[model samples]
Target: MRGKHAPRSTRWPIIILVIIAVILAPIIYGASSRNRTTKNQTTVSKKTSHSSISSSSSVKSSSTSSLSQSSSSSDVKLKSAWNTTKNKQLSAFMSQWQTEMNQTYSGTYDGQKPDYYGISFPTALENGRLSGHIKFDNQNTTVEWSPNANSSAKNQVLAVAVGQTSSNGYNRILYLFIAQEKQPKVYVSQTTNGEDLYFTETQNTALKDGFSQIYNSN
Candidate 1:
């Protein structure tokens, strides 16, 4: 004889519950994983958007700076081109020097060669200060000189030899003043003729032309 078994319907409910749990496990896990992937994608999209905005701003700023620099350069050139006062002043200054030399400048000997005058311009007008040189055509000599004064520095001898000379071609003496106007002075002076120290005040002359040439055109 054997013991009696449990009722058949009591085991049916338990078997059905087990089957339901097995099927739903994979579906629940899939749903949870899909939700996490969507969240990650949103975060990545935000980062990309922020990076693009920053890059665009940098490019815009660089382009703006370049445009500003170009505009500034153009303005400067335009200003220089339109400066009329300096041109007129420079031309008159040259004329005055030519006139004075013809009348007052004397040579050491008779029949000294005449000087040819030409002007040197600065890169910018900068108030029209300029330099020049005089070529002594007859003597085959040239001197780059500018107007000087008693306070001017012609004291140092050219070579410890007697520097001052009366020859029109050598010492390259300039009028102490030109028309009482401010004169352009160069850093250095040179002459192909014999060296001369500063000329006496008598050798230097001034006119009322109200303009002075700036420097030696050596």
Candidate 2:
């Protein structure tokens, strides 16, 4: 009887352990489910952060590319209008002036080379025509010319020959123009010490008219 009763007593401990496990099973499962949910949420948050960064970077890159393209287009337009070639009349005039300047300034002046002259097409002018302000010395009048209309004169070919000289800290700029027409005429304006020293043949009606045709026509 004692042996049978002792076996029954050992079975009580095993039964108690089974009951405790049954009670704790749901708690363990709930904890595991919460851990899985937290892991999923963390993964989603990381992906969202990466996506936002990528989108921002894409926008910045697009903006930079647009600005670069705009700048390149502007440069192309400027280069297209910058004229470097001279017409027949302009070529002859440039040659004559170059010869004269070289003869007058045979050596260097003020530590710089003399007879530095060339043709320059101002980009600021419409049709890239050569135009500037001319203020004569000791005079209150300032002469200026610029094209304003897109007429036949806009299509007219014009050229400017520029001659530069400097002496004793004083600089001179010589601008010459020869209208390309049936009767080509010459116009000259010279600047020294922030003032025009002289202008040649500017009052001639025929020459003025010829120049205006090209100068006023944008």
Candidate 3:
């Protein structure tokens, strides 16, 4: 009887331990599960933040590139327009003068024939007056002249004329002419000597006025 009672008491202690373990098992498991969920949520949040920053950076880069391209395109368009307008004005002035001069001088003068001519826009001006260098050149010679305030001819237009002279087998010679609005005398110079020479233009008033208008507009 003593042995059987001792065995039964030992069995009761073992049963109580089993019952406590069973009650704590579910609580421990729930705590562990919550810990795992919290860890996962934290990791996902970090990844989302990193992705947002990368996306924002990409958007900013794209915007900057677009603005740069737009600015470049605008500059190109402005340059093109300027070139077009310049060519048109130059063409009109050349046509008017060439036609008038050709009609006036149909014959050669002393074995000298006018070959071709070109007019240049004023490089520098002050207070609507020419105050800079006007350059003329050909295959052989290049000449430049500066007009100042004290210059007898405060001209705005510069014309370079090329003519063939019979001396030395029809050699080419260059002549420089300057003119202004309502001015009867056209300032003249040659490559040989850059001196003050003038010729009166009683005719071709329209040509002079047209050239003056172009210069002033510029």
TM-score of 3: 0.41
lDDT of each residue in 1-218, candidate 3, tens digit only: 35545633478889999999999999999999999999999999999999999999999999999999999997764343223354356455655555655422211111223332222222212232222233332222222232211233434233334434443433333333343432313332333323212233324466556644643442
Candidate 3 Cα deviation (angstroms), residue 190: 30
Score residue 159 of candidate 2 by CA lDDT: 43
- For residues 27-123, what per-residue lDDT tens digits would candidate 1 score against the true structure? 9999999999999999999999999999999999999999999999877644442123533444455456546555334221112222312211111
lDDT comparison, 1 vs 2, better candidate:
2
- Find the 10 residues in a row with the least total lDDT in model 3: 103-112
Against the unseen true structure, what C-alpha lDDT does each candidate score?
A: 0.38, 0.44, 0.44
Highest TM-score model number = 3
Per-residue lDDT tens digits of candidate 2, residues 1-218?
25545534488889999999999999999999999999999999999999999999999999999999999997764443312322333344345545655522221111222231322233322332233433233433322222111122322224433444544433544443433332233455554433223545445454345444433332
Give per-model TM-scores: 0.35, 0.39, 0.41
lDDT, model 2, position 48: 100
Candidate 1 overall lDDT versus native? 0.38
